[model samples]
Target: MLVLSLAIWAVKAQGGTFNYTQPDIDSGKALQDLSRIAKENALKRLSSSSSGCTADNVYFLLFHRVYIWIFEEKLRTTSMGGNGEKVNGSQGMLPGGTGGGCIKEGPFSNYTVNLGPLTARDPLAHNPRCLKRNLNTEICRASASLKNTTEVMLESPNIELFQANLQGDFRYPESRKWGFSVHGGGHFIIAGDPGSDFYFSDVAGTLTMMNRPPSRNGTLDDVLDLEPLGEAYTLGEMLDTVGGSPFCFVYE
Candidate 1:
């Protein structure tokens, strides 16, 4: 019976997909304590970093993903007395406006975040402030659909077509026609406030307005170089020209 129970627990721990959800605001006082603990752990990890937290780093996504993963792990263990069962997905209520107003509840409600000074030499220099959020439901609400879109992207038959779709024309409502715009929207919605590291900066925002010509040149490399293209190419290269300039790439 003990071995059977352990087997089931291990499967449950390792098999489930992380379903992203809003932070649970009504978790009460216990959540407050958990928030503090998570924040401290995150801060300690951040302080240990030479880069601190900034968009300049190419590995920003990876860094934060791991950071938050650790934070969530600690939060789960501490809150549930080390049961090791994965906690529910991230929690938070969606706000109604374009501006994602402040977060009022949940595990992170009581904890303060140190954003560090904008001009500080080290991006992680300790500058403490209340953790703020500008919750935009419009974009966040689209997260559900975005998840589905990602699944479709993964199953796409023509890799080149998939890449082209992601590099769709950079326009407003038009830009959203492609997956890239939606990707940026998710970030903006999550980090609606300026102080947040994920805040939608001008660099990414303005790139949406630039016109991108289709690949008139013959090769995938040429397409990436924005050269005129003659034919559609395949996924020979793993590079993602998703937003145009200020590109980021990651390999597993």
Candidate 2:
């Protein structure tokens, strides 16, 4: 009872915006609904009375929430355990598999996680489906260095398209797993561009890694170089053009 009280208090402190429908969720749809809510409302001010969340942004909020709670356990699975350096077993944060995009069971099956956008830096490289490396024949960089020379921006539908295709197993064999990093290399931001007018949105993907750690030196100028190709392409194709795979969160 005390634990439940404390949890309620914590939720209220964190803005109390998320509505937990069914505690025993057996399907992805329920989790998806929660994720949508988290995305619309700013996690910092989640308690605000409004449907500030969206289908695109909610997953990120859930990711941040779950990741922080299992930080110690995930850290242990990645670094401390045997074969931790290599991607094996259910060690990494979200072991990529069927319909496995962001949410994971965490250290314990009861502790389900939405794995928000910030988890791209996981050491194990679990989410290789959307990640791009220099080895990719179609997208591989000319230089040996993994850093990207150009920057790009992706829209919400595009992000959803990528997410939709990646909902199942990886299409390519080479893109199955990450060699160095655990989480995919990308960054999510709350609309850093002015001209684009795309504000307070959650964006993720390889294109964000062009500057190496998208957060440190990214700007609206980066988005200018990126063009929206209406046609869908493989993760490799997407990376080859923009120098990285790109996905963005936007209001519909």
Candidate 3:
């Protein structure tokens, strides 16, 4: 069941923590626990000098248990194999797993990704290929440990520091400087040919910001261009998640 009681203790020492377990997932107690814990911790904050509830306090262990359960407990295959449709070349083995290529079974077995593995020219050009995943627990253990995520979340004070530590900035590439960000850990949790390249890497944007001219520090006056998604708005109007103009929601 992987209770991780030790992990829970460690996180408690830090500030908060996620105590993931298989039974919690199977019995569906995890979601209920989140709602209940958040309410309790929020009330605790309301009456005390403690800081507000954060991700660690609200929902711990949900991602680890549920994600792993999907791949290891239910699906039961490390690799999502390929169907025998004719192909140009091999999908090849993903970084951490034994030999693997296209998905052959499951509901998403027939699904195909139509885009570049984008390490190629015309990256945005349409090119259909079978869905593939190289799920590896070893990779998760090496990169996404409780200590790794906890440090990134709690230790860093500012958004820039948090983002860099969580994303593993190249500016400071020492293992002693930071743990590989959980963002990378989570990405590789779904690791594969294209999974590695799956959405544009945020690290590049962070790098761009690091090297930009002065006055690049974002301000409320900053413009957010949603374009086709929505009209543009000043960053100030968007900061207040609950009452901000063009935005209305409160995080739980």
Candidate 4:
């Protein structure tokens, strides 16, 4: 009997058998409850702020984290390979030990979240072990050159850019879920226009506010103006040529 017990333990340790068990459903409920409380606090802060600037910033930050969490939980239930599907929580594992993003584009042109290799420059610069020599040259070049072309600014956790009430029935274009709110400010950056429908190559972080004018498509003038933030300039120095007229800049 002792020998049989030892053998079973050894096999289990060697991953020959799954330790079948149910997840703690109560823990899941607790997470949802926490999320609700956070939302309420964010709304109160946003509503009472003297300058809407700070409130809008806080709202977005909280919403972003909460939305990402909600999306991830939904994915775990509907998709395979979550944190522990094989041995509980192991399903979240990727080849390189990196987790997955909750928001992603789908296979059939619909946006479905996916787990893939890191394509950004900051991650590659911070951790070179993740990059492979035999990988595609284009991908490598893109990652390496990202810092030169991209600007990233982190928002403070205290600010909320979006409130929970703003989540009602709003959808981002070609996205999987509701539109993002403003508060926990976004990572402000000036990014290159890499053949996007939005603007010219020189324009940095120009978003389309409304209907696209047909005549302006594929032209330098089509893009919305990118202005300089006098304070907290995170992206590379604002180029003079791209600055255009001061009237081009839009303040949120």
In order of appearance, the predictions have TM-scores of 0.32, 0.22, 0.41, 0.19
Model 3 whole-model lDDT (C-alpha atoms): 0.49
Q: Which is the leading candidate under lDDT?
A: 3
Write down the worst ten-residue block by lDDT for model 1.
223-232
For candidate 1, give the lDDT of residue 71.
49
Q: Write the per-residue lDDT of candidate 3 for residues 139-233, one digit (tens) a residue.
A: 57767788777877787777667667866877754323654467677776665555323433332122223332233344456454323324445
For each candidate in turn, give its C-alpha RMSD to the true structure in angstroms. 20.3, 17.7, 21.2, 21.4
Write the number of the candidate with greater TM-score, choosing between 2 and 3: 3
Query: Candidate 1 residues 180-207, lDDT tens each?
Result: 3445555645453345335423232221
Model 1 residue runs over 4 Å out of place are 1-95, 98-100, 106-130, 143-176, 179-182, 200-252
Model 2: runs farther than 4 Å from truth?
1-14, 17-24, 43-169, 177-252
Q: Is candidate 2 or candidate 3 better by lDDT?
A: 3
Winner of 1 and 2 under lDDT: 1
Please identify which of the two predictions, 3 or 4, would achieve the higher TM-score against the true structure: 3
TM-score rank, highest first? 3, 1, 2, 4
- How many residue pairs in model 2 have overlapping backbones? 18
- Sort the predicted structures by lDDT, highest score first: 3, 1, 2, 4
Roughly what TM-score does model 2 have, to 2 decimal places? Answer: 0.22
